[model samples]
Target chain A: MAKQAPGVRIDGLTVVYKTPAGELPAVRDVTLTLEPGTITGIVGESGSGKSTMALSLLNAVQPPGRIAAGSVEIDGLGDVVGLRGEELRKARGKHIGYVFQAAQNSLNPLKTVGKQLLDLGRSHGVDDLRGLVREAKELLGRMGLDGARVLDSHQHELSGGMRQRVGIMLALVLNAHLVVLDEPTTALDMITQANILKIVREVHAERGLTTLVITHDIGVVAEVADRLAVMYGGRLVEQGPTRHVLGAPRHPYTRGLIRAIPRLVGDIAEAQALPGRPPTLATVPKEGCVFRERCPLRMDVCDTVDPEAHADGARAVACHAVTVKEHA
Target chain B: MVVIARRLAGHLARGVVMILVVATISFFIVRSIPGDPIAAHTQKLIEQGMAPEAAEQATRVLYGFQATGSLWEQYGDYVAGLLTFDLGQSVTHAGAPVTEVLGEAAKWTVLPVLAGTLLSFLVGIILGVYAAVKRSGKLGDVLAVSGSLLHGVPQYVLGLLLSAIFATLIPILPGDGPVDILYEPGFNAGYIGSLAEHAVLPVATYTLAAYGGWVLAMKSSVVTVLGDDFILAAELRGMKRSIVFRYIARNAILPLFTILALSLGLLLGGAVFIERIFNYPGLGLLLIESITMRDYALMGGAFLLITVSIIVANILADLFYSVIDPRVRSGEEVSA
Candidate 1:
């Protein structure tokens, strides 16, 4: 019953939040695509709008925030941005499974995991609830948990790692071909994070799913993602095959991000923290490249004109210096 | 199972201690009030043309206590009576037991106050959820403002205002008493109808006065729950709007249950003024009459009942909360 994994295309997607100063875009007009059956990761600093961009895929940006412009096209589901009400709701779980940022707090504290699982099945109009339960148990067991005991326990009874696993189980139990995991390991310890990432990769390949992992940690993306997309201040700075992007980043912002990760073996001073704070909604410049204030390769053109994403075969980078270098 | 039983036992023990303390304090407090009931009654009998000695004897026989008795002796008698579940006689009621008098009055207060509180809770919770969901809208503002306004209005004021409108202005419903004296007291429609008619004003007063508090409490609770990660996650899961709403309500309502139980206990005591304003013979009214007549036994009995109810309500709240919220159950078990 495994469906062929669906590719996702996010084109010119813009999400804005209403502020005292008026609507400010959290996600700017940018385009990216997920190849069928590939795991893609988008990494960014806090307030860089990576989470907002991910939410736009589900068209689930909360109020005080809205999708200003965009079309998110999945192979089976048409433009998600245009879907409304019951249609939009029905599409969420059955088609796109989302593991929320804090998997630890995502399950209802008042209910047993089994009860919540039944509730999920009932909400989706599942006729075979028993089958759904069996499937959920299998998924849980696959993740190295005692499925029966975990299902009967309340969320409080589960450790942080266990809760994160439960979150993953819930997402995959419905057999969604496209899954989004948002900071799935944020609160977990290093060992548990690695364990979860390993499970994620195994499950994605085993189920033939196209997955999107959203995080701020480069190490996370480097570990599991087939492709890496780096975001800074609401724009996709660079994206390509994970190894190539990490090995030789084209965008200066991506380079700084990679350099900021402290290494275990290297001289400690060699790892540098990026200078300046990330821009919040109010701080992002309106008419220039969003990263120019902190960009090491800032050109005159970066002050007034936004650089459009320039795509080469299987790779994209949005930076004036990169564009100039490529043309030269 | 063992944990739950232990917890229950713990709550019961604490409640018993609480009741005993309140009982002892109220017993002393009632005794310390000036003007002895025995002396007052004997003086009244003498004024009614009986001999002074005979009047004193009659007062002593009727009250079952000497005016000059030691405070410790009376306290011992009171404690002994309490141990046997005998609340002794009402000094003002001639031959009626304090328990019987309280029971009669309780029949009037408990149901109406309970009905009003629960009805208000239902109304408030529903409105509160609506308000929180539409927090930024005009309807939410209106409900919130009105709830605050009504909550601030004391029950007696509400009772008086309702009486003025329904009784004095329109004169449709009976203004006071549990039932009309003209009707034969039976299981018939007329008697039941009059009883309900007399109860309307007090119940309305209780509902209106307490309604705002529940609305405000529930609104804030729902608002907090709405912001929880699980709520957003549930919505993302494509749970139907109704299902999502159920999740929100179930979680939000958990905090309000303890408040609801305590309010149930407190509202009985608050019924004093409202009952007085409407002249409905509930425990509050009975308490007032007992105090005015210097009926120490009846006053102590009434106070004890109120204290007992409060303690019982708290215990029930703890147990009920544990039942609904597994987190609380485990914490309680650990503590127990």
Candidate 2:
């Protein structure tokens, strides 16, 4: 047995949001491990609780929501579930880094980009002032930016891609163990998106920093992630090595998602469009598989009983029809 | 700075046009009311042994109004006088130039409004930021509700209540007026002390009423900014909550600054009633006297000044908007 590398460890992570309508479980019973210096992609459509799962790492989930029953243990910091106040704040800034979507919106429009980066470094008690600035210069320089000019300019002065590159620089400044990027490149154009993904890979390799990248685009997962976890309706339906999962997606939902992507050179008829919208948290089925209503292979047993993940080699998938009818 | 200057120039040009329009409209509005200035004056003078008809004719000739053409001519002459800053004599005040009379009144009226506005702006911003940052708690809710509830109560009502408590019940402050008879304006310590003592009640009254508006504006703006995506971004960047607040509240507060300047302009006009209520002998009281005595020239001068004050205030607001927001490079850009 090989032990997972030191990074973020979550066991039975259940996040329930206390809305006005009642308790809504956003991320229900999710468990995954992110290895050190490895990129893990959590691919899910919107409302799949991927963002909620990311926010939980920083203890920054908006109010009326909480980690209901789970243990989220980072490598250095033991358990983050019950920590609060100054202790929680200290742990967050010193240990975890975050990069949000909409990089232009992320930087304060009022302050110069240089001032923001300097402040971030100083907050972490980086005392060598010139060293910090030099590193910031080098970082921006790496992202196809003239560090000196971009640093002095305000957020509004820069184009969208430049603003996102600066956002990545802010996240990576402190050399924190883990950086949580929730759709960091989503707002960028395709060319800029490729550039940002390249920068992410370069920085991860150089610093050996653990990276958890959340995106809906499987292309990003395929490019950067060593492993993939497919989240649907706030649950991790399948997870394994990227090559294994994408090559042979054992879960019906995963297979549908891969098929849905339009191939660049394939025939138009080969494109498989998944029908119906994703289910809301409230209307999620109580019986049978969560994807049963939309799944093509729905049997008599699937109507009466919910399916659990069955181990197939190193990959895990939650389809009873695949597990019982084929593997069993 | 270049942006602010360009916008200010455009506003100044508009202000000049506004002054002319307001003065012309004010002249006609005052004249259209049927009344003989001569007769009104003669009626008062007759009780003191002046021959009524001769005095009426003398007054009519002085006013240059023997026919309808003369009325138009009078209006034209008055407009010319205003352009040259030659506001004629105040008939009711007896030999004071309209400008001199207004100058004295303006000092009294402007003092309280200035004091109130400064306090309102400063206090309102601080309270607003605190309330927003601490929202979902008791203090924020209390601030929000109290500001709204107090804002609904008119300034005069608030003034009267404050006067009753501090001026009447406590007897620690003067109830009204800029200064008591004993107190005089000068460099002398005794006079200065007395003057300050007299100013306290009126200043407090004005501030209490105006504070609610500023507080409400800022509190709502700050709260709105707190919910902005930028604040969360700042948080994720590991910025201290206080630093995040500066970014959020300062940007959110830009529109309120314009509101502050515009309100200052209206405050000059609204102070008429407030001045009369306090018997402060300000522009409002002078205006009332001029209208009652048919002192057309003095009334025209006062109206022109008030209108000009409004235009200038708006121009200042425009300048401030440009200074605070980089996106608004020019008024032309804004319009485009």
Candidate 3:
């Protein structure tokens, strides 16, 4: 049974990690929205705080890292950041399902898939465990796996592609309308990744889900995401329709990321690697454009002032140079 | 069922081979030690004004072995006796069979040592998990430090300390012996109470000596398990705190099972000093007495028993591992 997909509105979301030096923002003032029944993918390199932003949806950011400032408003769930203890816990699987990064290692090795599914049901106070199992099996079957066989087997028995499907099944079995798939296809072969992304797209549409996919690869978002958001050093550098962003990227960081992806048909020398490493928690600029160091269009003002994401129509880009040109 | 049967058969076959190797080695080693008990006893009898031939005959009967046989011949006899489930007679105890003597002492040692070890394991695991869960807290630090401190102290030293406080200093419990001789050796309250009272110090010593290691091992294991993606995933899935805890404990405790089985096996041998300190008549005390008296049959039996127990424990651990972790059961399939 598919429910009406819920839209998520994240406003002024800032997550900070407590380090020896001090509390440093991992995600700073990020504002994005997942429109109902749409798949949004956020692309960023490692340490770009894309994952941190996703974690804020369920208020699942662990200790040493916390939602320092944020309002994640989900339709019918209120602001999730305000939920705590048992209330917060109940909201997670029931309202917001999260398919973790590395689905291969996400299932308990000691337990069979069915047993863990039963555990999940029991934890969520599902009285009809048999129904839950049936639903889980149905979900698995929909994903083109032998439901009973997959459920009976442990994680190690399943292939990477199979486990990823199992992860999706677990996320959807509870009928949660909002799903977050974090790095859903990182370790798989190219064929398996394509197959998984297709399953994700079909499942999202069939189930009427508002989905968020977080990954480092631009290809992943291009394949499945309706809308794309680009993150750089804890900032949402760009956001727009996937086709528009891919066709005409405005942010310097977004352009660099797209250029870095190797193409099979392109001239081998055309794909260029981005110069300078992504900034870590300690290295992220305290007050300036995070991508300015690597930006070819860097100006004097980029050294001192951080650009706010300025929206024009359906697209948004955060850069002083872009803002000046649009105004001019 | 067939897989289980095959696994059991394999374990038993390996255990038997291991026991046989250990038995053969121990038999030769015990025989090679200087000053045979039969010869020494015969010389003592001769010095006491008995005829040399008569004393030799008496010593042979007393020791229950022919001293004239070559080492290889004796080894063959030992192997034959082993095949028939006979461990030969005790040299020090005169007419008593080695099995009977050791079995009697084993009754005293096995239960108490087992109880102590299991108690320590349970307590240590519970505390260890708490410590790891609260690794950033004061209670966790205190428990960790205490575990390390107890783990480092020798068993005998702990035994002595326990005896000093509970026995000699306060005199609330009996200092030594399995039971007070005045109590009738039956299922009476007095006899059982005295038996339990006597067992307290030795068992406490065993528990305290081993508790720290379990605590530390469990803490580290839990810490590692906590870092696993599954643990975090479980938490994120809106599983109850208690459910998450069970997930954490179940996964964390897997590696410790093998260690637990090993320690259970090795603790029998380790009981020697603690048993000696408290004068608890267990296999350890019996083995020491046998060694001092040069009772080769009893010495060999004790060594073999220890070896057998260790192998049995290891086999059980392996079987139990497969039962708990399905991944281990179909390892070949997993690779495939």
Candidate 4:
């Protein structure tokens, strides 16, 4: 434990939801590392366990839910699996910071923004509330609102962008080392989304905060992520440095994702969409490649063997065809 | 301020129209009943008469019997009398003014209604918030189930049960009448405490009976609101559980506000049966009295007062709508 690296690390993390149909694994043996002072982008569509992964950090998943098997270890904090009562709360509040996707949510409408900020700041022992207010004012001012107005303002008074900025402020104010941002810009307009992402980048750099940004947009990953993890069917298909994974992709799923992105500068007609929708977790293929139904180069062996992570340079992919082709 | 004023004015206009229609309908409906007040009064005068002409003249003046006018003329005069706030003297009560009787009874009737409605609103909200926060667990499920169970039971049954237990068995509370505290009151705490003591059973009966409805409303609202994305967002902010509960409860509970306002308006109307069962001397009880005694003037005044009180309460609610809610402004802005 002492020798472990600083930041969030999950080894073989899995989550299963017990439904009327049966047990459905939402996250399947997903293992990755989010280093301190760096931003990691996780790209997946809805129901990709991107959210399940995020909630796993706080152990805040709803009932009929189970982590099943895995270890989620934060750098300074130990395993989050068994902690309960005040111990769990202290760890979640002090160590982990979470940012929800929507702006209209996350702040109390009944409370003033100043009070929300103050509550977080005071709880975490940032005794200098005046200084904190000054800092909050400065942050909101950068996002284009009168600093004084933001203090007295309720959430409804602000625009979507402003509300999201306040959300960012609420998460970052305590300077919690790890901030989990779940689709932070999805609900915003293009202009507002760009502004928010810009602010996120600026804040990350200025404070050296470690961020795990969950997004479905490959274009967003191309912009802000240092490394990328692509999840399909509740399992991570590929993860590596952003450039290598995007440019010299190995996994068939990863390859499909890049090819699917609409090309603005080149022939858009040449772009391809992923062959089929992501597989249902309830009835995932038992003894074969998860992507076999969609994979263009699937062999008979693909249906018989479960693929393991095969490394080619810094990139790791989970497909038998890719591994055999590269090895040959 | 302008919005509130405009809203109140609109409600007041509606209230005035409702009052006129209700008053007119009630007047005709009571009048259309079997016996005429004139004939009834004259019959008694005739029974005790010294001479037939004297009896006829006596009944005529008592009833404003105008042999020279048509029914329309009489109705016009009645409208005029109503406009001048003259409800006319009670035919049965012999010289007691209609307005004076109602004014005295209105306070007694409104007290129980006010107590019941407020208790229901407050208790329902608290319980609803509790049920929502605890949703998905045994506690939340239990609260929700129990609230539904109690809500499904008739209000009268609950009221009677309470009356039976406290009024009949223990005899700790005076179940039927308002205490004349000023006369028989002891100063252990003062007349106020004794008055409160006397009012306890009625308030409790009303409170217990009404609480279930509020609980169900609040619970459902909270559950639905909790499902919204905002609640998850707030939780992620690392806001304390208490703050989260408060914010979620207040915002999610907005629909309940209008329901509460409507309930407050219907309060006087609802109390009639309850007051009758308890023999409480409220407007509802008096209403029953006036109707049974065939006293048209008193009954008309009572009905008008209850209708006006309801309208006024709703108007007050409309005025207060924006005060408790910030989203109201944004909603108004969008609609405007």
Interface RMSD (C-alpha) of each candidate?
A: 1.0, 2.1, 1.1, 2.5
What is the C-alpha lDDT profile of model 2 across B1-336, one tens digit per residue? 555566677788888888888888998998877775667777766777778787777666655543355778877887788778887777656657889988988887788789888887898788877777677799988887777877888888877787788878998887677666775557888787777887776677677777778888887887777777777877876776667667887787888988888888887777766666667787777788788887877788788878878888888887777667665543454355
The positional error of residue B43 in candidate 2, measured at the CA in angstroms, is 4.0
Please give the lDDT score at residue B96 for candidate 3: 88
Residue A121 displacement (Å), model 3: 1.6
Candidate 3 C-alpha lDDT tens digits along B111-223: 99999999999999999999898889999999999999999998888999988998989998877888899999999999999889888888888889999999999999999
Model 4 alpha-carbon drift over 4 Å, by segment = A1-6, A87-95, A265-268, B24-34, B40-85, B135-142, B159-204, B330-336
Q: Candidate 1 on B166-233: residue-level lDDT in tens?
A: 99999988778878998999999999999899888888888898899999999999999999999899
Per-residue lDDT of model 3, residues A57-84, tens digit only? 9999988999988799999899999999
Q: lDDT, candidate 2, residue A108? A: 73
Clashing pairs in 2: none
lDDT of 1 by residue, A1-328 (tens): 6578999999999999999999999999869999999999999999889999888989999999999998999988899999999899988888999997654489888899999998889888999999999999999999999999999999888888898888888888888889999998898898999999999999999999999999998899999999999988898889999999999999999888878888899799999988998899999999989989988889999999999888888889999999999999
Sorting all predicted structures by lDDT, with the top scorer first, yields 3, 1, 2, 4
What is candidate 4's TM-score against the reference? Answer: 0.87
| Native contacts conserved, per model | 0.75, 0.41, 0.76, 0.44
Cα error of candidate 1 at position B309, Å: 0.4
Q: How many backbone clashes does candidate 4 have?
A: 5
Superior by DockQ: candidate 1 or candidate 2: 1
What's the DockQ for every one of the candidates?
A: 0.75, 0.48, 0.75, 0.44
lDDT of 4: 0.77
